[model samples]
Target chain A: MSATADAAGPGAVRFALEGRITAGTAAPIWKSATDTLVSHPNRPIVVDASKLEYVDDVGIALLFDLTRRERPPEAKVEIRDLAPNLATLIGAYDPKKFVPPAPERAHVGIIEQIGRATERQIEYAQQMLGFLGNCFKAMGLALTRRGVLRWGEVLDVATEAGANAVPIVLLIGFLMGVIIAFEIGLVAQQFGAVIFVVNGVGVAMLRELGPLMTAIVFAGRTGAAFAAQIGTQKVNEEVNAIHTFGLDPVHFLVLPRLVAATLVLPVLAVFADVIGLFGGALVMVGFDIGFVQFYYQLLGAVSMTDFLLGLAKAATFGFALAAIGCQRGLATGAGATSVGLSATSAVVTGIVVIVVIDGIFTVLTS
Target chain B: MTEPSSGTTQMSAVSVRGLRMGYGSRVLLDDASFDVARGEIMVILGGSGCGKSSLMKHMIGLYQPMAGDILIDGESIVQARGEAKAALQRKMGVMYQSGALFGSLNVLENVRFPLDQFTDLSLEQKNLTARMLLEQVEMAYAEGLMPGELSGGMLKRAGIARAMALGADILMLDEPSAGLDPITAANLDRTILSLRENLGFTFVVVTHELQSIFNIADRAIMLDPVSRSIIARGKPSELRDHATDARVRQFFNRQPDAALEQAA
Candidate 1:
């Protein structure tokens, strides 16, 4: 429990340390050493531990502090004849206080930044293609194998993504149709062509607006929901757990959402089209156009080709939205921030993909 | 640090040297070092935000240390990459604080996870192994139940079973009985002790529960927030009784040790 200091010679001091070196024992020893060092400022301190019995983390910490103290440039501290276990303990508990500086970054030109961006976009494209390919393979497997697909989960997702979304989709569609009819009727009245207002609303709602509006609604609602659900799973390591089980998350998670969205989007689009036409019919009756004339004109203007094309586009858009949302979720990084980022990116990517596919479809059809 | 002597000498399951841990520039622990001997249950105890779980995470390779290296079976996990890293990872299984079981998977399937990933065991063999591990944890009756359907104690048991799926030599558990009742926590401690005695796998458990510490720990290390390093290390009872540091004393005794505040 005691540390005895001896003045061996000028400019040198030796301390023989014995018994336990613990929190209780080290404090007195530390004071004695500090007193000795203050008396002989320029001397080299030698601590002999050959007779020491025990040491703990606190004891090791005290020794480390002693070794790291500021002293004269020529002064040194040394510990000798330490027991193997004590030495190991000291080595293990000693802290590395100095931190290395971070590596310097090289300057980058604009071209390099552009090149990096392009490379990132290309990589992202490749990943999306790979994911789509996996989805197709999973869908194929589901078709070939009777029980491989989680039909119950698919139905659940369908009810959630489609049936639950009906009210909002119909509301937005009806409002859009009413607005288009009113705006066109205001101009048509000046030229005595108010009857033609029904034609304008009918073409827009049936061929383009119906599917596009439904897809956008689903993207914001269901796609974001998919991202949030899967992102949370990723953060919780449940996704990793799935991987650990030798199961494909894309097959188990993404496939169900994809199947549900694709199956129900066309139905939603058809519903939106009917509701939007009814809105136009409401406006048409105000302008002295009968329900029969409005119905006849809507039928004449919107053929089966336009209606089927819109449904087809709705299905494609549904697939795109689901793919983007699930992909964002599956690719989520760790943390709470990443979950929000996944949801945000899912909506953005889903909308962008929907718009691009819609443009391509319009060009091909026109 | 030099490698421990091999063959005749007892080997440590995990060794940490000069560990500096923190986020970015904010250092939480400096000069952290310790070792868990093979087949020993080492409890990491600390006050809240003292980096107990952080230290465990570093040891299990969840996050890289700010400085210093961790070695498992004398191999430096920090320096290992690719196959070496994967091999090292395979030797250890981590049970997260939340159990982290796949919600979609039943208890049996959760336990079979590691086997499915790393082994060529047939479906029947995997199921049998999963059931056996579940039975060891007394969770066999809940084999068909989902994680969301389990109680706190049941989740912990199921998590332990899943962690044992691959027969990993080391298990790292982050607060195994954190939210359990006293009776359940004691039962978990007994389960851990018996598992250690039977399976001979080393465990590194991060927890602040005093009873569990005294019950299950072969050796324990207490992390001090003020020091930002280990302040005490020994058998839990030995530390509780003989620790000379007031902070250590305060911790084990569940005291405030605030004489100055009382006087004021």
Candidate 2:
């Protein structure tokens, strides 16, 4: 192939091409044309291809590059006297070299930012409520039909989420009791009323800390687990597969977790309360208070109302945690990162809901 | 192998010799051998769980064979280490069954990933290169879309673009036609054929789809689950017509092989 360039005018150049412009010969011609265009910037270039024999896709791409180059204003390109077949081929190729860049987003004001966040929150709350309603319906369906609930799966989930959680709950509850008693006893010693440490520990453990701590642990452990497990199932299309088989995932997967958490958490919380009292007893012994005296003071300080209220809080927190977890899981997006994000969101939302509900319970009781 | 006039010998782009592959003690394939010539499409054909994908994974160094070696362009990838291994790895690209595109990245960014990791190209050049590759696969329109936003067919096209990003001499694809409709699958086969003709890259495709096999395969090896070894090796039409093995004949004709069922 031969390419001959001639000056059309002061601001224009024309090239005459001949012979085949296949992949082999297109590169050098392309390089020379690009070099010539660079040297003569801001000039109209025309290719008179009447003598040209043939041009392939790569050859068309080279010609298209002339029009697509980043040049100063006043630079233009025109192809003339081209064969109709080559023109048709070039049209079909339609090399896109001048796609516009995406527009930069402007910053939003604080009010708009807050408004958008609130909108998202409302949407999330609506979805969660819908999920909860479906769970209740599924629960009712399971109750009406025998063997629909999968008692084996329910027992498995209960064992995994509840029985398996005993050690961590006991450890955290014991540490929390020790920390509280030590801090409060130090202050009470200053007032010469160290015996009041037993009352404070008993009341706190029975009324607030036991349920709150147990709920937070459940949120971190069982709630995150539920999200990751269901999210993975969602990613792998296993959730959809279940639906195709006429099984409700809420009934099969979530109801077991919710029921298990509700049944198991209060028992775990009571265990935590007893363990926390022992922790308080240990602190009281360190402060020279007898175990008998501490036990009597604890009995005098805690009442049936406080114990029942704490158990109620525990059960409610359990339900909220499991619900949020299952909701986050069912709402999982595609891919692995979404699974991780679901687990994280489950834990975060579960804790937030737990704390908010705990505050409401406290207000109602007060 | 005879040396060709193109400055390189007519050696296989990939060679698996006496390959025994499996997990732990369960042998999936035993004493399997194959050669994939340069610039030709080689298809690994089998029914479900017949270890076609396992063999592809072993050849790609994702899984080590229990015995034997894999050679890429005369270099032993099975025994290669460190920089040598990385060099061999850079010579080949893999497209997984699910596309396996990074979910966080847009189509353009996912295509640019291998180029970014291996090349010193400028940002603009990288973006241009990615766009060009996407255009080749007809995915340029969806460059800004996330992997999750793409349909199954579109995702596979994007994956092929990404696999071609590094300009690898060899490309391995697992189930390129899986989950796609018949027309889309045929179009994908056309894309593979055109790409091979234009770019001259060797392809090692693992697929059970009969139409895809007949359309794109220059040569194919069918694995038999019963024997746990290659049962047929030839062109698709040849295997479909003249294969003496009843199992291989059943496979190409899409019939339920009695032997396979009995083995199961």
Candidate 3:
């Protein structure tokens, strides 16, 4: 079997004897021959007939049995590189010839072959399109199917992506507002226009910075959580089980988190804006801008449109997180290594998509 | 579709005809045909890569057949949809080899899943039904524990509990005893028998476990590993008596003494 396994790599075994052959030579040769054919059935094998080996009728019968009327063991086997004259006695040297088999439809022509390849390419394109189509269908199902609200999962994502993230968003928002207000207040005072500091901080936070900064924070936080959660499920074959149960995994799993994040993010961005504006108000008031007047100017500069725009951007960022997280997780196969790879890909892809989408919205809204 | 005539001779739970399945040039099942009767536990036994799971998948309508018809209660599963598929699912319960309980859900939730999804049962009703099932499978204490917290035997029992949640008339258990200890395996078989006795549901169990086969199967079908064909199907005693095939005999020799006693 080992010898056969080694030699069988290229073909099925075959031999021919022209003179008196005994079992002594035949047995070992038969072993090697059957062993070779047994090991690698798919690869083509050829027995050289020009060596003029003679054999008895029994050895000849064994040879015939080995090559001519042999049952190919369970795998596809074909004999190739046969000499024409010996091929007659060897009975065409085609293993499939003896095995009654279904005939395949023949290729039409050269042009038709190319057309077939082109058709295959078209088929692949259709497959990819169908996969994407299914994704959209899943999105639609997500909207319609009311998932059993997993409060635990919600709190888990919240604790990990939201609560743990508050310190950073707050710190950044407060510092940025204070720095801008202080710098702008000094510059404004030189020109006796210190009132403008409130306008500067309010405009920046509400129009652009608040949403962008918070999304970037969450791009690190909840984005990673989504990847880890879904990736682990994929690794454990939990996703496959969902499909076996006739449930759309995306609708049951991804949609709730997506809805939660999308809803929560804009609210977080608004909170960031409020804190940032207040921080700026504190610095501006120290620079002789009256508290009431600073509040008035801040309100005037930051309109409902500004908050709405930031909310819109935050929503876009949310979509990016969900898409990247779900895509990477679904792409994962069953292993811890695959899950790790998926997590990294999720983060990278989420950040890229978020930035790209943010820029697109900024340009369009501008 | 053959309608079940008032409890005399049970109609076939699953009937497959001219079943031809292939992936690329590799044909797995070629013109395979078989019928499994109601209340008769049937096992599709085969070695690794012989398409036992694939055939089961087709039977369950997970993978569409390449070329053939699968009749579950006389309606082609391939042609089944909407209410038809839903009807089929409601009629049949499946337990995968891995005991695929949803990890996020605890044992109770896992068992309650089919009821919550398919039944109009209220939350309290679902919970009560789920608890009843867990108790039936002897996993009532494990109800609050997640799938990860359960042992292999416990997981299999939990899976079985979930399978029975909908009170499916036909249960399809794939490798239900694959990874369990001998005691656990025997317990699982006992549970299966109890389900049959109590609920009178038909079962189609796919497994290589001879112990399970003799313990639970009313009729066994041998899927030849080499030929990739159904070489024999009959009562285990008849298979032992009439089965001249070397592989079939080899399978019988390996059956546990408990299975043989159960068969007797």
Top model number, TM-score: 2
**What tens digits encode model 3's per-residue C-alpha lDDT throughout A137-229?**
766765676554555666666666666777888887777778878988888899987777777788788877788888877877777778778
Off by over 4 Å in 3: A1-366, B1-9, B240-242, B254-264
What would the per-residue lDDT of candidate 1 be over residues A1-366, giving only the tens digit for each residue? 678899767767998777765433455676676677777678898888777665532344445545656678777777788765545434542233211222245899999999999998898889999999999999899999998889999999999999999999999889878888888888999999988888898889988899999999999999999999999999778999999999999988999999999999999998899999888888878888889999988788878899899999999999999998999998877556678888999999899889999999999999
Kindly report which residue pairs in candidate 2 clash with one another: none
User: Which runs in model 2 stand beyond 4 Å of their true positions?
Assistant: A1-40, A43-67, A70-93, A103-109, A137-148, A244-247, B1-5, B258-264
User: lDDT-based ranking, best first?
Assistant: 2, 1, 3
The DockQ score of candidate 3 comes to: 0.02
Error of 1 at A320 (Å): 21
DockQ category of candidate 2? acceptable
Residue-wise C-alpha lDDT for candidate 3, range B181-233, written one tens digit per residue: 99889988987886665445678888988778888888887776467578888
Off by over 4 Å in 1: A1-211, A214-223, A226-366, B1-7, B257-264
Model 2: how far residue B151 lies from native, Å: 2.2
Per-residue error for A68 in candidate 3, Å, reads 76
Top candidate, metric lDDT = 2
Between prediction 1 and prediction 2, which has the larger DockQ? Answer: 2
